[model samples]
Target: METLFWLEDSIVGMTVSSTQWGYPIVLSLHAIGMGTLVGVALMLTIRVLGFAPAIPVTSMAPYWRVALGGFFLNLLSGSALFCGNASELFFNWAFRIKIVLVLVGLALTWWLVQICVKRSDQISPAHRILAALAMVTWLSAIIFGRLIGYWS
Candidate 1:
């Protein structure tokens, strides 16, 4: 598409593709963001599933801010990376699957968070199921994202 070509040829794309440090730095940041986001989600999901009954679920609520920060970081860095190779990525099956998984994971995460926050004292089986689903979805998204590098 013309738009993809334009984005790939844009200044941001040029910097990411041309500069020696640009791609690495942005990619590293993306990884850090993914770790931060997924780590928090996993921790929260574990807690919600009653792994650490000693710790209150309400305490985990604040970590959502950290997850949100990581999401924004990923959004920005991912955008830059995509701009660098929009044409290739746009048609990449792995990339498309990753995007869908991310969306579903985010929805599940939000639902899990709401359950945790609203019923901190009582985690129903449904809540646990949601938390497990969120964990799996997030992990799958990460896997698909990694596959993008080798998907060709």
Candidate 2:
């Protein structure tokens, strides 16, 4: 609690919280990152789940680079966004849920990537499950993230 309050009161937080454009800019970045991350994840997951059998999963390999970039961008922007309201976010149940979902989503995305790298021809049942889980995790994270504002 003390640490969160300290972060909320820190220079970075103050700038984000007080500046008229700062919060919005950071938030917009976060949204862009989210779109990239979730959109690419969904596309890959759909391939793994055998939606578009014509497109080889390996062909989607380049997307992982884009997804990783999005993840890093989200990490940076989300951290700044969190800093702006650390005290409240730290105590928000929805925020915690969002974090967990994102972590799980990341793990699932990793597994999906591994599957793609190994056997892009015919995906196994496990790969399909992981792909489905990834979709659910990402979507749930988005839902929980949206709920954070209402909850806090």
Candidate 3:
């Protein structure tokens, strides 16, 4: 309780919550990061599921750097956002679900990436299943995140 209050009272939190432009800027960056991270992952997942047979799965490995960049961006921005409302968000069911989904989605994505990078040939059935799970997990995370504001 004390820690949450301190976080909410921190400089980063105050800036994000008090300044009109601050929240918008941070929220926009979060959105951009989410789009970059999820968009690239979705593309790779689709390709692995046999959507674009022309593009080699191995070639998609290079795009992981873009996803990593977005991940870092989100890490920074999300921390700030959370600090701004630490006490309330900490108890929010939607926020908790979103965090769990993000973790699961990240793990699934990493596993899929390893398979894609190691095997230059066709993706195995198991790997395709992992990709599908990652897709669903990430999309669920997004939906839950969006629901946080409206959730009681």
Local distance difference test scores for all models: 0.90, 0.90, 0.90
Ranking by TM-score: 3, 1, 2
How well is each residue in 59-96 modelled by candidate 3, as lDDT tens digits?
88889989989988898999999999999999999999
Residue-by-residue lDDT tens digits, candidate 1, 31-104: 99899888989998988888989888888888988998998899999999999999999999999999999889
TM-score of 2: 0.95
| Number of backbone-clashing residue pairs for each candidate, in the order shown | 0, 0, 0
Better of 1 and 3 by TM-score: 3
Clashing pairs in 2: none
lDDT of 2 by residue, 1-152 (tens): 88898888888788789999989999999999999999999999888888878887888888888999999999999999999999889989999999999999988898888777555576889888889899999999999999999996
Model 3, residue 113: C-alpha shift (Å): 0.4
Shift of residue 122 alpha carbon in model 1, Å:
1.0
Looking at candidate 2, what is the lDDT of residue 102?
Answer: 95
Give the residue spans of candidate 2 off by over 4 A.
Answer: none
Give Cα distance to truth, residue 37, candidate 1, Å. Answer: 0.8
lDDT of 3 at 94: 98
For model 1, the superposed segments whose C-alpha errors exceed 4 Å read: none
